[model samples]
Target: MATIDLTSDAFEKTVTADGIVMVDFWAEWCGPCKAFGPVYEAASEKNPDITFAKIDTEAQQEIAGALEIRSIPTLMIFRDGIQLFSQPGALPGHALDDLIDQVKAIDMDEVRAEIAKQTDEPSDAD
Candidate 1:
């Protein structure tokens, strides 16, 4: 699948939907970002089921600021609207592929159970 360009308008829908999303925060001029572009694009093509988005830090400064993107080429992975992992810097294609594999390997049922446990608190009176 093709990568969608992220902006203030599309950011919410793209990141918050139910499924896996991988967002790359980058700038055109950043050398490392440029180097990682092809790898990111290839990954998106390989994983059509996962939503892949790229936010140009220069064009979408507000979004960048909101996400606290301190460095170029920051990759954040979200599953079911919740952030699962985040990292900064340029990574090789293999490393990124491995990361994706690891994320996919997560047992979502366990995660949901954990969330339910945390939120299922007893009343204070008890």
Candidate 2:
């Protein structure tokens, strides 16, 4: 599947949807973002089951700000409404593939449990 462009209006709904979603935050003026665009597109074709979405930082500044994206070509992976991975910098094709594999291999049940435990624990500030 080809990547879909995301705006602030759609960002929440798209990332919160079930299944895996890969969001690429980029800008037209960034060289690395240009280089990584094709790699991201290729991965989308290869992984048809996943949702590949792009947020043009120039056009969607609000969303970028909300996500605290300080760099172009930032990649974020979300699964089952939870963020599993977030990193800045462009990834090569092989690295992107490896990342997809790692995300796929994650045991979400364990992740949920870990989140639950953290939330249940009392905060040091309390």
- Give all candidates' CA lDDT scores: 0.91, 0.96
Report how far off residue 35 is in candidate 1 (Å).
0.2
Q: Residue-wise lDDT of candidate 1 within 1-126, one digit each (tens)?
A: 489988899888878899899999999899999999999999999999899999999999999998899998999999888789889999999999999999899988888888898789776777
Could you tally the backbone clashes for each prediction? Answer: 0, 0
Tell me the tens digit of each residue's lDDT in model 2 across 6-121.
99888999999999999999999999999999999999999999999999999999999989999989999999999998999999999999999999999999999999999999
**TM-score to true structure, per model:** 0.88, 0.96
Model 1, TM vs. native: 0.88
Hey, what RMSD does candidate 1 come out at? Answer: 3.1
lDDT of 2: 0.96
The lDDT of model 1 is 0.91
